[model samples]
Target chain A: MHRRIVSLWFPRLASDRILRINPVEAPFAVTHHEKNMERLYCLNSQAVQQGLVQGMGLSDARALCPDLRTGPANLHADHHFLSALLRWADRYCPWVGFDGNDSLLLDVTGSTHLLGGEEEMLEDIHQRLTHSRLHVRSGLAGTRGAAWAISRYSKGIVPQDKLKIALSPLPVAALRLDDATCTALQRLGLRTIGELMAMPRATISRRFSLDVVRRMDQALGDQSEQIEPEAPKISYAARITFPDPIGLYGDVIAGLERLLNRICNKLKRQESGARALRLICQRVDQAAVQAELRLARPMREAECILPLFERSVRELDAGYGIDQLRLEAFDVEPLPLVQVDANTAHQDSGDALDDLITRLGSRIGLDNIIRFLPAESHVPERAFVEASAAYTSPESKWPRNQGSQRPLRLFSPEPINATSRIPPRKFCWRRMHFSLVKATGPERIAPEWWLDDPSWRSGVRDYWHIETKQGRRLWMFYTPRHPAWFVQGEFA
Target chain B: MAELEQFFPLEIGRAHEVCGAGASAFAAMACGADRSDNARTILWLQLDWQSDIVNPVGMTPFCDPSRIILARAKNQQMLLSCAEEALRSGAVSHVITELYRPLDLTAGRRLQLAAEMGKATGILIVSEGMGSNAAQTRWQCSPECPTSVSDGHNPKTAGLTVLHWELIKNKKGTLGSWKVCWNAQAHRIIVVSEACQ
Candidate 1:
């Protein structure tokens, strides 16, 4: 099979993209900062005709063309436009790839016949792009390198028999060599492709790099070059349209059930589960109403997922009636198939727990549901960390600390009025007076110096387990240096 | 029956209430005592407005902190709904909730029915006074001065403080009160003194 590659180059993509939206007739140039200097990145045809070339400093360009209008170059926007063009070029060839930021390479092998032969296909592509006001220069040849060289330096088709004669007049830079290598070749008087071709292959390989010889061989069809085509994105969405608009809740649920079955079956085949799903309900006389569902864990079962959407779907106003329903499964994760025995069918409690968490999270947020994990810190406040139950896996065991006693309920430290430091015979907390019946004291703990904890700025603390006459067991601490006391927790 | 006499046997598939200052401590002890080899998960729920949180380090003396799942609800309605949902799932062994206000009879009955349906225990730690509800047991827990040390300031018994548990209401058994303390080495509550009514 003969491989015919097409190269399409957009010479002024950045400048033309701006001009297409806000049409400017005067000479305009797009400038970008490079090496701490503003250089002309792309030039419009009007600016080029006024003797302003790309890479010229903005100051020099203004001197050359006094009426030159300048705008900042948005390379990101230009790249996105070029990608959209690549997808648009899919109509001419199935295999199309990006060549640099400004060009595209399409291998239209045997499919060009569908658009009435190779010449007609090129003409069609040129007319369509020009209709969209994009400056496109295209070349078709037997090899990718030859097509690329002809597209930038020359335009038109290159015959297979006259490939050498066709690329001979082009400069050595046409072979995609580095600036230094091209300068070196030009210094030795090897300026054109024909002159470099006449040199001995051994000397060229020894003196220059292997790239020079490889590029020449690839252009002349001796070495094969492959173009990486972009693959189409696969969307995991299913949609169903009813012949007549259905408004009842039961009818809508029936339609949702069918859609869920279709999407779940697709997920099962790929061994993937949906973590987040979106449902779009298209109405007859109004715009679409949408609802979203988030799962605690990746799930693919239709039965388990259908119920989670029931409340949200019921709340969605059907307006006049819903004529179409679309279900899309995003945030997909790989969930390998698990083999279950018939004897253990009723013993899968993990799924039930996850389902419950998902239901509760949809109402009260998943962040509110948490589990405790032990932290390696002596500071009482930093001793434990909370992890979301919906996201984190359950730990098997917690590391046991056989240290000093800790309070059952911990709260922000509240200052209490006490007369003396020794467990205060009488103190007031939360506007309530309590007299201490028994007191255990003075387990001194120092703050971690490395951490500038605001609560620990009171210096070292001496803790006490004090029981009150009113049957209140409180965890009290007194700062020796600050001479103050605070009630921080309760044994309850 | 004799083996269960030493410890308060919280009936499975039923609702219970604990009030007063040491309710949370009593709930933790009950959860630890009822935990078996298969039953591990305990769901603990609290209101969002409440500033106090359960310290994992403190809970380690009674229950394994890793076996607990904590949730905070915005209001009482959400808390009760979440408790009922967790109980009805049958995924956890026990569901413990901290109620700011007293639970009504209807809400308590709903929780009881859900617990019975799922075969899980439900424990409510109420802050306010208890109302008439369908709970199987109601307890009042308070702290008691340590009697082991005469001076009440001995360093040896510094970490050992006793709690007084008064079983004020019981449908299945007689009312009683006992002074108990957590034995860390045995991982169980031991009775220091007992009083029957």
Candidate 2:
């Protein structure tokens, strides 16, 4: 069987897209900044008829037509629209790919009969796109290269046996060569593809590049070119469609229960679980209501997942009635099966802890529930790090600190109104006065010189564990360079 | 000392309150005293507005910081709900919460019921003096200065932290007062002397 390929070209994609949204009668052009000048990127049919070609400066284009409307070119939006068109083209055939910025290539081999024939498919696509106010030119042939060249230079279909004759009349620029290469080939009296092919292959490869010969062979069906088809996304979704729309809350819960059972059973078979899930309720009035859930751990049990959705489902308004309920599970992870024995049953506390974390996270977020992990630093504030309990497992052993005793509660250093190198006789803090009874020796701790810590800008500190007469033990540090005392923590 | 050993491990499945200057340290010691083989985790809840945070480096002297899970709540309602949920799960051996305002009798009763249902201990660290609540016991803790002694050259007190705890309210035991210090090397609390009334 012969392979059939189709090429589609959009002559004025940028200008047509803008005009489609807001129709204009005057000539319009899209301009982009290049070489420190605003040059025309694409033009509408009205602008083309006024003799304003692409790459012309905006000033020059204004001189040609006084009523020319101009807008900046948006390449990103054009590419996004082209991809949407690719998905729309999937109805014609499954093997659709992007050819260039302004064209699409579809391989309709063995499937053209379903659309009546090759000629009928092309005509149907042209009529539909034209009715939608889009200008599209299409060509069908046996090879991709031949189809591409025929679409831009000429119009019609090329049979499999006469591929060479159909592509011969097209200009040498249609062979997908650079402007410099095409100009050089034209200088040698080769203006058409037929003339270039009549020359000796060895002579052409020597004078020009080997790309010329390879392109010729590909267009003639002598060299094979493959088309890469876009893979469809895999969806883990289950839906229940009702004959009659249900508006009761109990009915919605019943429908959701059935959907969860089906989805959980499917996940159990694959030894996988979901960490994020989305529930979409399609209403009969053409409106959709969605609720999303995030779990701390991957779970597949129907009973465990059902309660998490209860609060969200109760809040959803089943406007008019809901005809369909769809459940989608994403962020999947592999969850191995564990057997339930006496020893394992006793260790179910871990599962209960995970459930508790998930419930709390639903209210206060998982980041607020934290566990402390020992950090490798000697600084009092940097000695430990906080990690979310949902993500990090608890460490079995914590490295013991062999330095001076640390305070029970730590605070960002608050300066006190005392200026004594030794413990003061009395000091005021938080509107209270405390008289020192006995104090320990100063433990000098130098700042880490490698790091530029703003908090440690006061240079080296001399720490003292002071006992006050008011039954309060405070950890105070004095900076010798700054000549100040600051209370950093409490021994509560 | 023998009678103190019986008090070392506070009765499980009950709710207690510790207030005053040394409440946090006393509650940390109580949480560390649970050396059971089955329950290994401890849940600690506090308000997000509290400026002072528990330092893991300092907590190492009482309990292993790795065994503690800290939860910060936005309001008092969230704090109490989190404490009740954690205590009712039975996954943790103890649930310790720091309360800025005193807990009412109804909320205290709910917490006590949760602890009983899960067979877990609940400890509340109140900032001010105790109020009317359904707690099993109430303790008032304060820091006490150690006695200074002169050896030969320099005169210094023994470098151990001393605290005085008074049992202000007890439903099942006698009210008493004792001065105790934490022994870091042995990882236990030792009674220094009975307070002179």
Clashes of each: 0, 0
- Candidate 1 has an interface RMSD (Å) of 1.6
Q: What TM-score does each of the candidates earn?
A: 0.79, 0.82
lDDT of each: 0.86, 0.86
True contacts kept of each: 0.75, 0.67
Compared with the true structure, what per-residue lDDT tens digits does model 2 show for residues A1-492? 999999999988998889899889989999999989999999998999999999999999999999999999999999988887888899999999988889899999998988799888899999989988899988898888988899989988999988888888889988888999999999999999999989999999999999999888888888999888767644579999999999898898899889999989988988888888889999999999987777778999999988878767888999999999999997788888978788667567788888888777766777899999988777789888999998898884666757687899999998888886777889988788888987886998888899999999999999999888787899999999999888888895
Share of native interface contacts present in candidate 1: 0.75
Error of 1 at B106 (Å): 3.4
- Candidate DockQ values, in order, are 0.58, 0.63
Q: In model 1 chain A, where is the ten-residue run with the lowest total lDDT?
A: A394-403
**What is candidate 2's TM-score against the reference?**
0.82
